[model samples]
Target: MVFRTLFSVIVVFDIVSKQIIVIRDKLPYLKAIVQYKGELNKDYPDTYTWAKFLELGKSVEDSVVDNIIKEQKPGQCAVLIYTSGTTANPKGVMLSHDNLTWTTKALLDTIGSDKAEEVTKCTISYLPSTHISGMSSLAAG
Candidate 1:
């Protein structure tokens, strides 16, 4: 329900359903909360409810976080955005950490904001999460 509240679209599948329409349509993989009538399936593959997914964050060890941070580099890919197939088939565009950081800095400079801590900022993101602009906005924030 929390995920549904955050996202406009929710792809629900019945336990006995033969096909998931979104997946069948070749849409990008979406974060989902599967619905079932019987007992919760702990061993279900690639399935997680919003609460269950959030619980995973609580269980992460500090060392794991530290190791992830240590593994990151400026040139490493931060995100991959698939372009809308307006002209041709959709293609994934990889954005590096340096690319995102540079864009964020450029945005701040253009807005005459010296530091993020200098002022309060509020944003209401309406663009789809898959879009480059949307991803950039989230990264900049």
Candidate 2:
């Protein structure tokens, strides 16, 4: 995945290339859109704005959502987090929903917080969202 930073917004690019490899290489990938501008760029066709994503979400039926939720399991992979490439290429760490929930519960217990909502309402988080530590804080709250 290629992430292009524009201001505080990050644009996800399907093809992580320096040039227009989509046309030259005939790569099979979707187009990219600039989220801030809410416009489709010729160079990036696979991207969609946040608004578009929300719109797509709104189109999903409640039954479909319920069905997906029912299919979810604690042992299933919830997220694939990429490690910081300090030595080699960044490696993806697969974390299950159970793992995150367990960590969250442990953190909350350690902090003596019975209600996550209360802590979340007052907490000011400054950690990077990409890191596990940041994820744990967010999940705990």
Candidate 3:
């Protein structure tokens, strides 16, 4: 019984740790529109606009990430999107795990892990995730 229990615990930890590693690779893409309770509750001022940011974040959490994670695929189709920001100009962009990996490698060539390691803790600072910069940042961790 003791052996079985220990084995089960190890299995569970291994599974969860694998998931965290996958997410860690793509951590840059997710930006929090609102302050988290755990991090913000200490030595932080609560402002009126913060409420709105939370609302927006909740909306996104419900619609985007929730829906995306619901699908489990060994390898998924690439998501192709267009970038149209404040400027009326729009351009097509395609993203997949392959693209993300290649881009990350290119980035690594320039800055290396110096900046990447320091950016462990990241938050989303912008609204309207329909832009290329936002999507690229989100896709390539």
Which window of ten consecutive residues has the lowest lDDT sum in model 2?
Answer: 1-10
lDDT of 1 by residue, 88-126 (tens): 976667788888788767766765566543432675568
How does candidate 2 fare on TM-score?
0.64
**Which number leads on TM-score?**
2
**In model 1, which regions exceed 4 Å deviation?**
1-44, 114-120, 124-127
TM for every model, in the order presented, reads 0.58, 0.64, 0.31
Give the clash count for each candidate.
0, 9, 3
Q: What's the residue-level lDDT of 86 in candidate 3? A: 54
Query: lDDT of each structure?
Result: 0.56, 0.60, 0.42
Candidate 2 vs candidate 3: which has greater lDDT? Answer: 2
lDDT of 2 by residue, 1-141 (tens): 223211122333334232433432343342443353434444344446566756867989999999988998988977765676799977767788888888777878877776776777777667665566678788776
Candidate 3 lDDT over 15-88, as tens digits, reads: 33344334433444333223322233223122213444546556565567867767635344355444543586
RMSD (CA, angstroms), candidate 3: 18.2
